[model samples]
Target: MSSEAPDPLQHIGAALFRPLGVEGVYARTALYEDLVERLTAFISRQRDRSAEILRFPPLMSREQLEKSGYLKSFPNLLGCVCALQGTEAEIRAAAERYEEGADWTRALAPADLVLSPAACYPVYPLVARRGAVPPDGLLFDVAADCFRREPSRSLDRLQSFRMREFVRIGPPEEILAFRQHWMERAQRLAAQLALPCRLDAASDPFFGRVGQVMAVSQLQQSLKFELLIPYYAGAKPTACMSFNYHRDQFGVIWGLKDEAGATAHTGCVAFGMDRLAVALFCVHGLELARWPGSVRAALAL
Candidate 1:
């Protein structure tokens, strides 16, 4: 290995964070909340005007996850929710002991929940159970805490974070138009933020041999594109947002049918909330004082 000293985030911050890299950040007494709040409002504005705002718990049912095919497509990266089982008294005692430099023996079992990996994962069933999707469609503004398994540490990649998504399910044309519209809107949003960015077609890093083939096929097929920017001040750009078209995949699986009995088309514009914060920090700097006036006002910083 032609190795230099290891990347600091690699050894130090597995999930919570390290200093040299920012896979995670703890913005404690800092005033980034104003920026985060402004960003959240901005995301909601991008959704359909009539869209319902939905908030989901960080963990989801494993059965729900299975039906969603998350286990199949990304088993390696999935996080199952579990709890440490014990009597109430035992739990209290264990907690007390743990605080005293001891380890608890009761381990968590793989019960029902799993850490949700995306903001839209819980949406399919919610729409499906609502009976037939209207001819017009259903739109939602969803934000959730998400978790993922990662191999390397970079400013862009976080193991646990937040995501906001604008989701739509309806006619194919509507879904196509929604994704296309966001792709264009993203350009404007980036400009408004005054952050330099680029749009590029991207593919998920699938697993193993068959996955490699599928990833290559996906790249050739051009199913997804991302809006990337310089978060780490390096050559490789980080994806701040992505526009995805799922054709009939979720429609077929979740039975999200339009009024005409056609499998409803699904698409989403997803923003990596934490990554956006990172991008803003990297572009604008640690001090909020030097931020561009318009962007600062937009963020209410």
Candidate 2:
């Protein structure tokens, strides 16, 4: 019955992750894998209702991400592609040597792809190149192993995580209105799940001194709001679902124009699938039937 958000790490198991050492959760977790199955199923059902169901891997072109304004705003969180040089046999020997506690470079001969920080960044260009989307616009359902570096290792905040997003592209008003509509819908949906959630304006945790100014501008413009559910002992609450309205940002950058000969106003509803599963587990315990019927059915608990 607590209205406060749980301590970001309140639900994450300490002992469960202790064996992971310094790298910790970034490397692996059995619990996350199990929840992955549940989340994939949930997203699949929702995607079928409105999305084209495009799957994107955990990589984006470094150039594309930079053009998307990522480097300036969140340089600290980005995971860049890197490579190591050596003969093929030397590389093989290094790989084997690393297993034996010898130094082995974790870089590739040529960088493959940069790790994606969000699930939807790749969707914009895909829709753009398709050439002339339907008058109604396009919906993309995408998931990825997103990477972001945080100063803290608290369970609520992670360096690497999975994210699933539903993106909408089209006319200015239609996309803006889509975000506005879903904000309300998420509240009702939260109620059904019996999870106390709040609609609060928010922004990405920008890095460095300049980032402070950027964060201020973001809030002043009211560009984002997250439906937060408490996860840990913290009072501020964890954001579970986010409704973001990117006005002309992605459109201008990716050429996602609409029928009106205007750059599309884009929006997305992002759900922290893993965090949500954690919230439900903590708030309602592992027992599925004991929970509210609607919530149980929604997650197929």
Candidate 3:
């Protein structure tokens, strides 16, 4: 190996994010945690409307995931929880086989839970259970530890991550308006953070030929927009935030209706917490103390 010292930013990142054996998984440092706290606080302080704040665990019901159509779209990226199901004696036998270098994982069976693909996936079903929403509509600040099956060394894409989402369920006009309003607000937020970003029409990486058509339709309808930020030097930017106009997608799927007896429309603004953190480090340098005063003040870090 060359004797040259490592890139200073890489050195700093290594110190801050202790990567586990798995790529994109890390033990975050205290500074990272502090940054997240400040971001969350900044988001909270900027709210003009009251919202029902909800936090869900990482795991979601498999039935719900199926109902949400995620399996049809991105089946390859779905992570299902599975466990060895058998009598104690059978389980012991499987363990023994594994200890002997055999593929004992075959004994594992699907559990009822799957890792949540997005923070908002569980919210619609829960809201549907409450029956019709008021004419004024429902707004929720929901967050969750989310996961995807992607395995990459890129710091911006994680196998497991956290998402902060603001979801709205209401009439079609109101839902679309809500998304447009947040798109503007997100632009302002990026300016405040002094992070260089651009909004672009985007779509999920849907699987197969049929899924490709779906993705095309989604973009054609301008259903999704993403905020892109540079996450690494000499590399193209990555999406750190997504503003989605689901229209009546989730609302129809969950049979959610408004007080007017019309299908409720849905929209959400989702922030990729880890990706934003990485972008900050990329743009602001390794030392928060040396970052621009305005940026520090904006994040209160």
lDDT of 2 by residue, 201-241 (tens): 99878888888888888899988999888753455688988
Model 1 alpha-carbon drift over 4 Å, by segment: 1-29, 85-107
1-301 per-residue lDDT for model 1 (tens digits): 8778765333222332334443443332334456667899876666667998999988887898899877877889888866666798877887777788777655445778889989898999988888999878988999898988873446578677789998988998998998899999999988888889999998887777878887788778777899999754564788899998888889999988877788998999999987887678777776788999988877766
Clashes of each: 0, 10, 0
Q: Write the per-residue lDDT of candidate 3 for residues 1-301, one digit (tens) a residue.
A: 8998555357557756987889877899997888888888888876656799999999989999999999999999999999988899999998899789999988999999999989999999999999998898889998999989999866777898999999998988888898999889998998988898889999989999998999999999999999998765666888999999988889889999977789998999999988888788888877899999898899876
Error of 3 at 234 (Å): 4.5
Better of 2 and 3 by TM-score: 3
Off by over 4 Å in 3: 1-9, 232-234
User: Scored by CA lDDT, what does every candidate get?
Assistant: 0.80, 0.74, 0.88
Of candidates 3 and 1, the better by TM-score: 3
Q: Model 3, residue 273: displacement in angstroms? A: 0.5
User: What's the distance in Å from true for residue 133, model 1?
Assistant: 0.6
